[model samples]
Target: MTHPRPPRSVLSRLRSQLVVSVQADDGSPLRDSRIIAALARAAEVGGAAGLRVRSAGDVRAVRAVSALPLIGLTKTWRTDTEVYITPTPGEARELAELGCELVAFDATRRPRPHPVAEMVAAIQGSGALALADVSTLAEAEAAMADGADVVSTALSGYTPNSPRQEEPDFELMRALTAAGIPFFAEGRLRTPAEAARALDLGAHAVVVGSAITRPDDITRWFAAALRDAAERTVSPVTEAL
Candidate 1:
């Protein structure tokens, strides 16, 4: 049986929930496919509201394992491309083939491989919802102008900076509160407290990663602590030998 697509309720839950991006950037796991599946299933079992999967293979991996509604993103590097998620109508169609209910893409001031309106039309043409990943009011407005189903504050401080990754500015979130579309607080949210704060400020959803599903970062935290402790542990050279 086909699962029902995630509704606006997912947006509402995003206010205080974590949507795990279980897939890696390479679109292939260094481990096994079952590892990704277990991670996604564990997230859902542990109360994650949804899954934001990258790549078609990762989507396929998670789809068979977890019943969580998926928000799919396909990352293709095109020389002329500035946007990644469903950058073209073909990518959008690919998302639908993989059973993505909602497709997200960059809706910034930069040029997109596929124009915003045309992309929206294509997703609509395919009967899937479109999500606008924007960083500012103007971008959000432009996406709304293009008929986006939901507006996300995901890429807010990344692009236009060039070379450095910055956190989402609180001012942008404040500005987005009045945009008349569902507001999703994404990127760099470090803890559950921050998630609560975003929703309290009227955000529709808050997408968090690194802190949850990315064990590499978390493991580094532990490794650094061990390194520091090891440094502090003094032993007589002869005894140690």
Candidate 2:
């Protein structure tokens, strides 16, 4: 069955804009829906064009506070499959029903509980656009062929098939661009410069997460850098000797 493409107005609003992912991992102190709502508000104040939120509670909280378009998903860890992002059709429908303009799901080639087309239909049937999070160009193409409205580079570096690196996957972005696939540049985008670079590489838009929302992750990144610097430093006495 054919699904309607995402509205042009929604896509136009996101073009060349920053979409912040406001989510806190399980066991994180900031995992509360209230905190997520606050962060979403802060993102809007900071000029985020859209939000990528996780879980129904957090999405509801964010919706209560901000009018920015939302890209929503659920991370469910199952012993059966590695496909965690909005793993089930029920989850995708729930995210769309909760007012997400777009529902994101793992569209990687790994074994999944449901087919990519089923997930796409679920989202579109629920009145939302389907945004497939993929790790490779091949996966992106497959998802589009399966009726996904758009793809995001959010699974890069997370999948074993993709390059695991400290930097954003510019290679994948370039590949997607060359393939003429419109996509959101996400995952490991840590700075404004990197975000801008993704757009220069032909990304539909940029999605930044840890650098803006996850203070714990941001602190760890800084702490690790400082530790590395300290380890590289030699004592003054050693230098004198």
TM for every model, in the order presented, reads 0.81, 0.95
Model 1 per-residue lDDT tens digits across residues 96-180: 5687767777777787777888877776566567788886788888888888888778887777832234444556677788656
Candidate 2, residue 108: CA error in Å?
Answer: 0.2
lDDT of 1 at 219: 83
In order, the Cα lDDT scores of the candidates are 0.73, 0.94
How far is each candidate from the true structure, as Cα RMSD in Å? 4.3, 2.7
Could you say which candidate leads in lDDT? 2
